[model samples]
Target: MKNLLVILFSQALVNNFMLARILGTCPFIGVSQQVETATGMSLAVVFVMTMASAISWLVQHLILNPLNMGYLQTVAFILVIAALVQLIEMLLKKNSPGLYKALGIYLPLITTNCAVLGVAIVNIGAGYSFVESAVSGAAGGLGWGLAIIVFAAIRERQQLAPIPKAMQGFPLALVTTGLLAMAFLGFSGFNVAKFVGM
Candidate 1:
């Protein structure tokens, strides 16, 4: 239990997919203009990532390894992720047309979000068990959501603050993101395994 908690925290903070690993920057920057949109995108990513990790883990162990088709891991993972994004898109379109429209291209872009694939690959590379992969996926997603939402909040606030002409818009955002990433780097020294008595 302690180990699981440590894994969750490590993924969500110490090794965040967005702020730490820097996997899914497109959506992190493009869809983070508003907190509501960021929240929705985060939820979608969380759902898809968790499901993808579990399914990919199963496929890796049950089919790929047995068939000696490890080379197909990337293609197989992309297929699974793309399918999951489509399903989420349909559900969102049916239930929340507003959010669907707000998300626009970024919603579909989740299919290609490197963070999703990165987590799946990381799970496999780390030799994590089924439950560990799922937890890591969920934690990674949460980390992404947390970073984007916080960034959005900061950007929202920045709207009111006076800024130099040269640092307006994307320039300012990039600087802020860099600073935030540096801040997150502080967690690198944390040792989750030792904390959890591993």
Candidate 2:
């Protein structure tokens, strides 16, 4: 339980997806002009990451590890994530038209989100248990969601504020990301392994 808490906090705040990991910068800059869009993207990313991690974990432990086929790990995991995202997109379209509309084409882009793949690879590298992997995956998603939402909020507000012509849009968003990354550096001392007696 304590270890779980540590992983959650570490991923969600100490090492955020955007602020710390620097993953998924495309959407972070391209579609984050609005809070609603940011939130929708975040949720889609969360679902993808969680499912990808779980599926990847199962593949690694049950199929890859047993068959000694670790070389195909990346290919297998990516395939699974892609298929899962498609399924999710279909489910959302069928069950919740409003959410599907809000998500729009972003659901398909989840396949390319490095953050989702990062979580799956990280789980394997960290040698996390099933529960730990799930926790970390969710935490990664939460961290991503929080970072994008915060960034979107800031950028939205910044639109009305004065700014140099040269430092607008992409440039300004990059600067914001760099500063946020520096802030997250303050949590580097947090150690989940130590706290959990690993």
In model 2, the runs with Cα more than 4 Å from the true position are 95-102, 191-198
User: Weakest 10 consecutive residues, lDDT, candidate 2?
Assistant: 98-107
> What is the Cα-based lDDT of residue 124 in candidate 2?
95
lDDT tens digits by residue: candidate 2, 62-134: 9999999999999998898899889988888898787778766677878888888889999999999988998
Residue 167 lDDT (model 2): 96
Taken over the whole model, the C-alpha lDDT of each candidate is: 0.94, 0.86
**Quick one: best TM-score, which candidate?**
1
**Worst 10-residue lDDT window, candidate 1:** 1-10
**With candidate 1 superimposed using the best TM-score fit, by how many Å does residue 117's alpha carbon deviate from the native?**
0.4
TM-score of each: 0.97, 0.90
- Model 1 spans with C-alpha error above 4 angstroms: none
